[model samples]
Target: MTEQTTGRLKVRLVDGLLILIMAVLAGCGLIYEYLLSHYAGRVLGAVEHAIFATIGIMIVAMGFGAFAARKIKDAFSGFAWLELYICFIGASSILFIAAAIGFTFHLPQLISDTFNLPADVLPRGGWVEQLHQIARYLPYVSAACLGFFIGIEIPLIARVREALYQKHLTHNAGTVYGADYIGAGIGAALWIGWMMSLDINQAAVITASTNLLIGFLILLLFWQKIRWRLLLTACQLLMLAFVIVLSAYGQNWMNSFTDMLYRDQVVLQQQTQYQQIVLTERNLQLNNNPTQTSVLQLYLNGRLQFSSMDERIYHEMLIHPVMASAPKHDSVLLIGGGDGLALREIFKWPVHSVDMVELDPMMISLFKQPRQFLPIRLAKQVIELNANSLSDERLNLMYADAFNQVDQLVAQGRIYDVIVVDLPDPNHPDLNKLYTNHFYTRLQQLLNADGVLVVQSTSPYHAQDAFIAIGKTIADANFSAVEQYHQNVPSFGQWGWSVAVKQGLPVSERLKHSLAAQTMPVIKTQWLTWPIVLASFNFPQGFYKNYVNIKVNRLGSQQLFNYHDQAWRKQQGMVNLNSNQQISP
Candidate 1:
């Protein structure tokens, strides 16, 4: 071969290697973004805000990093060091955030234990509060640091390419960025398709491992131009060993960190596509011996769903009122009760068939069938708690989003005698949609003329305005009768529900008629009685009478989410109330 041909081939090989490095690093950068945002959302309790805010902070930091990259005189060494920093930070970021938040969560208790303080005597709204606020924001801080490193990549890569070719290429920026964009697209696809469902620590380690590998490749290909070649290789090997250990034991360490956040012992925790599901167990000690009737609690996305000690109260109250009030119990539609506790209550009546729509199949499967993944004792307790109601042949489970499922049901002209909505609180915009007037209207189409619909509204005492807005939103859907009621569940204080009748008598009157008729057998329950069911309809005077201009939660306007967020923030002392904003009449 001619000398010119050999020289050209060498330059081309160097150029191709640089582009490939950029593409893989771009993928790693995107995964780091998702990993931080998802972990923040899970721990912070405001999923939507945490995810979006973290991403926004990271994007701005990336811009800053790009501008600052010009300060580095040696592009080859700079790019190599940038990958090392990103890898280390990305791998350990989740663990650091979890520890910070977990410490803040346990700080009050630690202070109480140290000083022999009573339950109500601990400190509030001082350094303790400041620490908590700071801890809650650690994820964003980590995002900024990681994003800064990621931003340095493109500029340094372009500089390194020019240095390798001995001249500035006019299209260098465009070519490098094109590879970046394509790699980012692939990263997003992997996150949505597979990585989201994996253990969070594993995902972080995998992304970090890719960065470490790419950094080693850079060290091999450009040894002469790069400084501290031996040290750089050693650092890469050390990082690779650290990542290997993280892949093996990181999840167990993560669980220990998370376990500090809960009062009870966390037995099983899993991350599904939809949300994080955690099961905790509290033992009742009788003379230092654990009782057989221990309490099991289910939490979704850091919010408690139900506790075994008092779940009977919640499930019975949710199911029996509507089931008893409806004229027929042959067919029913249940939305969002994936736990199967409500189904256990419904089966007490002579219901012929039930169609349940739950968005998360993992939730249903956890309660329905035994799996080898769960500890043997937890599996038994979970299945027996709901009395294995999910395995009954009468259940027709449809794994679908309730919003789209209701629309399909309306289109199919399906009718039900009773419809129960046992969903989580409206802490997110997607959940707010399910509580909107448009959604209720679609559900209204699926009910028979005399059928009843009951919704699990949030707490009347803590979130009075949100509770009121939900009832008003349902009434705006044009139901004949709408009434709000409340009961105290120990795990969740002062919970409430709203019942609506399509036509004829209201829920109270229909329930009274059902009680008066003696032909059917009395439906027995642990927590609900005839008088208690009737009394739940009677709230404190002026509770439902809203004097302020509280608007209905339409589809687009997230008024309900705003109300719920503000109410809870005020309750936690995170926000100062405005004199103009009165939730209760």
Candidate 2:
């Protein structure tokens, strides 16, 4: 081959490798952003806000990173270093955040042990609270770091490509940016289709490995021109080895760190496509006896779903009021109670058929097929708690979004005597739709003529505006009558529910008459009785009188989400204020 032809071929090879690296790095960068946001939402307790804020901050940081890339004189070495930093930070970000939060959670105990002070006497508004505030920012900090490195990548790669060509490429920006955007699209698909199925830490390690490989490829392709070739290669190899080791033991490290975040031991933890599922167990001994009482608690995205000790109170209250008030209980529709506790209550009646729609199949499986690794007693506790309700022959379980499923049911001409909405609170914006008038109106269509519907509203005391808005929204759905009730379950204080019946039928009169007619419940309940059912509808005077002018939740406005967020913030503020007051001299 001629010398000129050989030079041209070498340039082509360098350009091809650089472009390919750009695409792969783009995919890795986007996944790192998603991982940070997902972890933030899981640890911080507000999924919607955490995700939005993390993405927003990362985008801004990306802009800063692109601007900073202009100062790099050597694109090849800069891009290589950027990959190493991104790999290190992205892979270890979650573990670092988990460790920080875990340390903060145990800070008070650490202080108690270090100084030999009584736990109760530790200063409530001291280092522990400050550490918590700092921990909350860790996710954002990690995101910015990842974004800055990712921001530097494309520009650096473009410069290197231009240098290799020895001429200014006509569509340099378009080529670089097009590859990045397309690669990000592929990354999102991989995340949803495959990566999400793995444990979060494993996914992070995989992305980190991709990043390390890209750095090594860049070093190898430009070895003749690059400085410190051996040192850079060694560093990349060390990082790759470390990431591989982390992937093998990441779950155990995560579990140990996560265990520190909770008061109870984390017996089981899984990252499903939708959310993180964690099961915690605590053993309590009565009067120092050898026999211990085990409490199994289920948490979704770090929000407690139910505790074994007092779930009966929550489930019974959720199911019975609507069932007893309905004209018939032969057919029932349950939404979002995947744990089967609600179904257990429904099975008590002579219901011939039951339909349940839960969004997460993993949640259902966890309850259906108890894991052997779980403490046998704790695993059995869940089965006993749900009473193996899913195993019943009459249940028609559907794993799908309840909102969409309810709409389809309407199209199918399906109707139910009692519809129990046992979903979690409208804490996230996605969940806000389920609590909106739009969803409830569709639900109203699916109810039988004399049917009754009950919704598990949030806490009446803590989230009063949210609770009241839920009732108002249900009434706006054209239900003839609506009533709100609450019960104090030890696990959750002052929890509430809203019940609605067909238009023109008084829910109170039906409930009263139903209780008076039936001297005893058809099925026995541990906490619910006829008298308690009657009393639930009777709140103290002026309990809701102050909540006038509360807007009904609508799909477009999402008033419930705002009210819910504000109420929880206020509740948290009051708790902190109370703690400060109690600890003050």
Number of the predicted model whose lDDT against the real structure is largest: 1
lDDT score at residue 524, model 2, on the 0-100 scale: 89
lDDT at position 398, candidate 2: 96
Which stretches in model 1 have alpha-carbon errors above 4 Å? 111-125, 285-291, 370-373, 516-521, 545-548, 574-585
Write model 2 residue lDDT over 281-341, tens digit each, in one string.
Answer: 8878788775576788888877788988889998999888778777788889999888889
Q: For model 2, what is the C-alpha lDDT against the true structure? A: 0.83
What is candidate 1's lDDT per residue for 1-585, written digit by digit as tens?
999999999989989988988888888888888989888876665667888998898889999999999999999888887788888999998988888877876787788899999987766457886787788789999999998888989999999999888898999999999999999988999999999888888899999988888888888888898999889888888998889888888989999988887879998788987887888888875776734667888888777888899999988898888887888988899998898999999999999999999999999988887555467767787788898999989999999999999999998999999999999999888899999999999989899989999999999989999999999999999899998888888778788999999898898887777678753348888878878978988888887677367789999899999999888677756331111011110
Candidate 1 lDDT trough over 10 residues, lowest sum: 576-585
Backbone collision count in every prediction? 0, 1
Measured with C-alpha atoms, the lDDT of residue 111 in candidate 2 is: 75
